[model samples]
Target: MSVSHLIKHSAITTGILSLASFGLAASPSQAVSVDFSSWDKLGDVYTQPGEASLSNDNANFQDDSPQASGYYNLSGNNPEEASPNPNLQDFLGLDAESLDDDGQAYEGSAIKSVITAQAGDKLSFEWRFSTNETSNKDFGFFLVNNNVIKLADFTNALQSGTSGSFQTNTGFNTFSYTFNSAGTYNLGFGVVDVGDYVTSSALDVKNGNLEEVPEPTTIVGSLILVSAGLLERSRKKARK
Candidate 1:
């Protein structure tokens, strides 16, 4: 093919890629949130990028056992009790928990998905971590990026009771993070048990959302405009 033909083809390909990156081409003002109302359905959340499985494990849902009110109970005994084999903090390459706590013992699950958003976009969710096994134990949410643990900005403090208290009436505690660039992000929500014992904590989360910013579209448009200009120049040169 001639150089002009190649330029035209390239421009067309780029424009299609730009549209694909936008996912649903939602208005910049709208934000997408994931929530669960019943054990059977999780609104707008998935385990994988393209698949529709909502729960990573079948035992994660506790609508009847704990009267969960549509929340996940991140317990250690989902499939079976964790052996407390390895200290989770060490396994995750994080500093050890405060010495006053039980050793690193993690028995939990995390839900992951490839979330699309632009630079400056904000993604957030609400969670409650409760454990009666305080005295140096906790659970938290981790945001994984590119297979690495990027942030652990939200974790619960040690509680004084065995029964976890759900803040459903007044709303759960909110955790938010902002994206610095536009692309696919490996977003994750997890719950963990930080001590060695059968006593487990619970991580109840709801209302996950991605608040998109409009800047990425502007960038894509500029690229298309430049590509169109180049294509025009190529056509003029070929005709001469």
Candidate 2:
């Protein structure tokens, strides 16, 4: 082949290769679908009308660092309805009768959503737990299919600056869980005033996501096949 023909063929090959690489690199990964609209107040948890909120503003809670898009807030306060959720009390291992006898109330605010996920799917979220009751056993919690997971408690949380009415706060933390079996799950986030209802506690959650684990071997194999086909087509065009 002449030098000019060699240069033209080489340029075409380089261009096609670059395009193939870009296509593979720029491909979006699969994300598990989360129905944000499905979020609703958990069973009969005691809360005022404005206690549960979904908003984009984190500054309202004095969080200097905000998260992407929006966040869910569940704040517990003095029982407005006095109707504590038995399910939540059971989850917390609190005796409702004993609490009532002691003049203490178990007030909670929680939001729950039903999600369908496959095995190996990972769910994650960023959360901050804040509270005003330093002496009481206020806490923040997360649940997967009724299995309670404690996020933070009054004793464990750091003495950071106030969050809304809460005098103490815990900085943003991350929680992630991988599904072990393919099925539907109930996801929950909440805060509760354990010993006293006089003070309040809040849980803030943002960037909730469920994502499918990528199979590197399969993805790489498919990309290779696609690149090979592209290269073959380019070779045929160059010949013409």
Candidate 3:
């Protein structure tokens, strides 16, 4: 083979080898998870608009009067405390009315993203829903995969719940759903002032994550090695 042809062939083989190596090492299941402690500060994996623009905070929102607390937090109280009061349950619906009767109205905040995933991967988050409207006017936690809506619970309505009065409720209220197929999905999480911000419903969402389930390294490595051999054979043929 001519020197130019050899160089060209070598370059092609190198590219193929590189791609094969990458494909084996980088499995869709092994993609990094997107975790969020609070909406204000999303980690490197997540993306969101300005906090001010999106009221992803522990504030009351309504049409007549919008109460923007201008703060982003996972819960109204310390999550680590023994008797931690997840804001979602402590201050919504009947409880909200007791504080301020007139403040009852629709209040909510939503953040969404397009996540690429593989089968066996999971999307999970911890949330507490507090609402008097258990039937219709309730908290909604959803994941819109493609065009289908997957509810965190059996229904869109999430009733009032908490970790407990004294014990720290770690993993007390968690929502997790595994992906069935490999594809792009639009995942979202938020709290809405169902019915009214007063007859209010609150949702304390935190530790949101997309868990990645990657393929075994040995399998990936084996595939790469096989591809490399093919490339080597092609190089020999070119030389001949």
Candidate 4:
């Protein structure tokens, strides 16, 4: 319970957390680039972080449903293309009938996938929005685990209003959630219509085959040094 003891324990606990993260990352049990149309089994598709194009289109997806099921409709997120939606210059359109004439298939649903993770798990993803949109606008993220304690780690609470694309962004605005208990949790994202007013988008779960990449040899050495320092501090305190 002493201050020095707490410091020593803190270092060890951090090492443990890092180890857990790496373990998850290394495990092949985590999914990667799941097909959006049938994403329930695996995680969902993330489109934007890809190189030239992003598509959860029925083009390669299972069921060929034209649109993925969970994308919520805000301004122009609807896939029907019955009315023309303004396209952003940098944004790619899938299932939107290739409004740019580049010949990319469009499916219109931005809800790429739904994923669930346990404590010490991190969820990282990317998304983009118009300069026309708010900076911190909620793109739709939720927690279903009854025992989750993201409250301690959240930079911001998961907001349910607002609409944009996270599943489609090439770079991710990652959300890290570490759970506190074991149970069947159902973390989900946008599929809500919300009466044609405001809407939200789902995150594309990626880098999901969680693995702890080995730190650089230098980092490993630094860790050893820090451990030694903690031990020295503990010994010094014991002498007093």
Candidate 5:
């Protein structure tokens, strides 16, 4: 190959490499569409009409301020009125027979939302669990497609505060999940009264997000095609 042709080929390869580097370094992450108003109630009774709420203020647990938050509670005026939630039981891997009297009746409240994500996409959010229950059985948890991912047991909570009659934990914990395949998923958060339904427990969730991740193989494949096209052009010019 002539000197000029070699120079052109080198320039093309250099430009392609630079573009690939930039793309890998600065790939933009997209904002996930979370409809705060579209969250569906998952459990049976909510204690009161407004026990579950959507808001931007940090009034619930005095934790981090969020763009928007969905809160669910297991406390109310009447503790006996609280009923066992079958869906929550399913998520916890417990059966109706296991949640009988003898101070083991489990009641819970939760909110769920449907979201679409691509393979390798990441979903993340901040959650806080607050309760006045002295028993360690009462806890907070999250679910993906009705399957429990993590349980925030009362014994694990290191922080403590007060929110009305209930003792609160003002610390917010972050949770993240990466989808293995592209599809729609149901994401949910809730608080459960494990032993008895006397004391109230609440869950606060905020800043829900999903980020699209670019595959490295895809980027490499495009670079290979560009390199091939540029080399072909260089060969044709050399022939001339």
Candidate 6:
């Protein structure tokens, strides 16, 4: 081939390689599905440690760690003495207003699995309420991303929960998180508010679940380059 033709071919090949790289980056991240339903509650299974502070009457029934009960925990919580939301019972329409009513066990919740998603990727949750409250129980869910839950990020990523005491309650709350796809994150249950953050070694987290995005103009430029790559390739092949 002539020098000019060789140059043209070389440039086209480089462009193709560049476009493929961008496409791969734009692709979604791989996901890891974990199960902890059968995980055991690692503590004084029979004893309600935080009972007195939150409510001395906590767990009127079985309170062993759910892991001991033969189930995987999608999520779990071990509060440092905060009482189980009494509203959970009130919302149940049951006569009892708290888990303390029937004398149950207080098995700490568990997190069975984790998911890794990229920025702009929408990750959702399905909350299964296991509360015994038949009257006024209200449960909430929150996304603990890198341990940050400000109003801006919280509302942007996952459902924003109300802190403090609210008269309303629900069977379950489901929401989505718009991951920046940065460091790893752990999803937690229980009082999902500013103060609900708990530390645990057993929980699973996939790094880069919330990566921040490039500036708006940069993304637009990348898209334009991708489009141009496609158009140029088509033209060159047609002429060939």
- Report the C-alpha lDDT of model 3 over 1-240, residue by residue, as the tens digit: 778667766775676666565554544444344544333322111233222111223332231223333223333421110012223223221232222212232344444556688788887765654333433333334535423232222143423344321111122367778889999876655444433333333344555667788666546666666667766776777767
lDDT ranking, best first: 5, 2, 1, 3, 4, 6
lDDT of 6: 0.32
- What TM-scores do the predictions have? 0.47, 0.57, 0.42, 0.29, 0.61, 0.34
lDDT of each: 0.46, 0.56, 0.43, 0.33, 0.57, 0.32
lDDT of 4 at 128: 23
Q: Let me know the TM-score candidate 5 reaches against the reference structure.
A: 0.61
Cα TM-score of candidate 1: 0.47
Candidate 3 off by > 4 Å: 1-33, 37-107, 132-136, 146-171, 195-197, 216-240
Which candidate number would show the highest TM-score if scored against the true structure? 5
Candidate 5 achieves a global lDDT of 0.57
* RMSD, every candidate, angstroms: 11.8, 10.8, 13.0, 15.5, 9.1, 13.7
Model 2 scores a TM of: 0.57
Off by over 4 Å in 5: 1-4, 7-27, 42-105, 163-165, 215-240
Clashing pairs in 3: 93-200, 104-198, 105-196, 105-197, 105-198, 107-193
In candidate 4, what are the lDDT values of residues 1-240, reduced to their tens digit? 678687777776677456444333222234244233343221123333331112222222222123344333222223322124422111222232322221221222323234544544444333322111123232222334222111111113233333543322223445444445433444432211111212222333443332222334445555555766766666677567
User: What are the per-residue Cα lDDT tens digits for candidate 6 across 66-178?
Assistant: 22321222222232232354232222222222223122212232221244544565554433222222232223223353232211112122322244211122323344567
> Which candidate do you rate higher for lDDT, 1 or 5?
5
Off by over 4 Å in 1: 1-28, 35-102, 146-171, 216-240
TM-score of 6: 0.34
Point out the higher-scoring one by lDDT: 3 or 6.
Answer: 3
Report lDDT (Cα) of residue 135, candidate 5: 61
**Deviation (Å) of 39 in candidate 1:** 13
From the highest TM-score down, the ranking of the candidates is: 5, 2, 1, 3, 6, 4
